[model samples]
Target: MTRTNASLIGFSAVALWSLLALFTVASAPVPPLQLSALTFAIGGVLGLVWLWVRGDLKALRAVPLKAYVFGTLGLFGYHFLYFTALRLAPPAEAGLICYMWPLLIVVFSGLLPGETLRKGHILGAMLAFLGAGLIVAGGLSGVSGAITGYAIAFVAALTWAGYSLGSRRMKAVPTAAVAVYCLATAILSGVAHLATEITVWPGSSLGWLAILGLGLGPVGLAFYTWDIGVKGGDIQLLGTASYAAPLLSTLVLVVAGLASASLSLALAAALITGGAVLAARAGRQA
Candidate 1:
């Protein structure tokens, strides 16, 4: 695919992912681990079905064990931490914390071979983190909850950044990597579900719809598109552009009554978006 097309795909994936918090919030009464298992299980099945329909099931043979291991750790680790964080804290606060992945990506990508860390990259990341810190501080005030959850969200950011960086090295096996990721996450989350929480299905239509939406949009197709984008497109631009997703997500939450907007959110949005733009421009110049 053309680079432009690939970037659009990445944007699409981010947009789909923006809805994740809303669906996760709607799927309440289901434990985080169990929710991860169910949605990923459904998504995995759908992915396999897609491969079969496309006559690409043979591609799975090319996937290395390492891909399965790292990809699963990345995909599962992220959502598991993310869902758990949401349950432990307010969704808005937790979401902002988790969105730290984009800045982390810019930071971690610099560590990769052939990638140079620049002043603008550092400057932009600092600005973004400053904004993110404001968000966390603002949201945490007067809120009493498990600090462990917030810490988990931070780890989720790292996991996602690592996953994205690792993915760059596996460009030759994109489809296989994503397939293994889905399957492994499904299996791991299934085990976590059995060990941690009793299985309880979503009892309402809206709940079922949320699961369906998640499986199809974020967990299924979005992963596929992202694998393509990250492997084939300009990773810098895509990573920077990703800052928009959380802002969009927060807006959706506010509209849906799941979260309230605050001055911190607006300020964070400006800082993050502006910083990301600066970074992307700097990358282009370099």
Candidate 2:
């Protein structure tokens, strides 16, 4: 596929991820590690089915052990932290903080070979960080309660950004390898859950459906598409486009009545979006 096509496929992941917070919240009372295990298992099965249909199941065998380890850690670490953050903190505020991955992606991409870190990039990052500060400041009244979640969300953002950039470096790794990564993540999560978390299945059909939606969309196909995109597409463009996810996600939460709309969220969205645009422009000029 052309770079444009690859980038478009990558952007589709962003659209799917917009529903992440909503589905995660809806799948409530299911502890983070347990939820990760269930959703990732479903996602892994989806990937395996696709590979079988495409006759690409054999491609996984040639993948390096390091790639498997890296991918597993990346997927498992990010989702575990994200789910825990949302469980502990308000979904909207926590989601916004986690959305820092987009800005982090743009900034971190500068460290890649052949990429230049322009002044505009730095300025944009500062602006985006200020937006995140707004999110944290808005929750200051309850900081004593939510501080750990916010910190974890910040680290989750860092984890995902690192994963995306690391994927770019491993361009030769087949996208199908992510299937193995998903399964491995599921196993790791399951072990952790069994050791620490009590089993809490979905209490209702709606809750179960929410888990299915997450498995099929954000956690499942999103990773596959993202792997293809970062390896072959315009990484900087994808990073800039990713800022839209927070806005779309927050809107979804509001529409579903899972989160109330707030002025701080609106302002944070604007700053994040505008900062990404500015950073993208700088990248183009370079």
lDDT of model 1, residue 125: 73
Put down candidate 1 lDDT per residue, 198-247, tens digits, no spaces.
88888899998998888888788888888888877767667776776666
Give the per-residue Cα lDDT of candidate 2 at 94: 81
- Backbone N/Cα/C clashes per model: 0, 0
| RMSD of candidates 1 onward, in order | 2.7, 2.8
Q: Write the per-residue lDDT of candidate 2 for residues 214-244, one digit (tens) a residue.
A: 9999989999999998888768768767766
Please give the range of 10 consecutive residues that has the lowest summed lDDT in model 1: 132-141
Best by lDDT: 2
User: Please, what is the whole-model Cα lDDT of each candidate in the order they appear?
Assistant: 0.79, 0.85
Instruction: Give the Å shift of residue 195 in candidate 1.
Output: 1.0
Return the TM-score for candidate 2, rounded to 2 decimals: 0.87
| Off by more than 4 A, model 2 | 83-99, 128-142, 145-154
For candidate 2, what is the lDDT?
A: 0.85
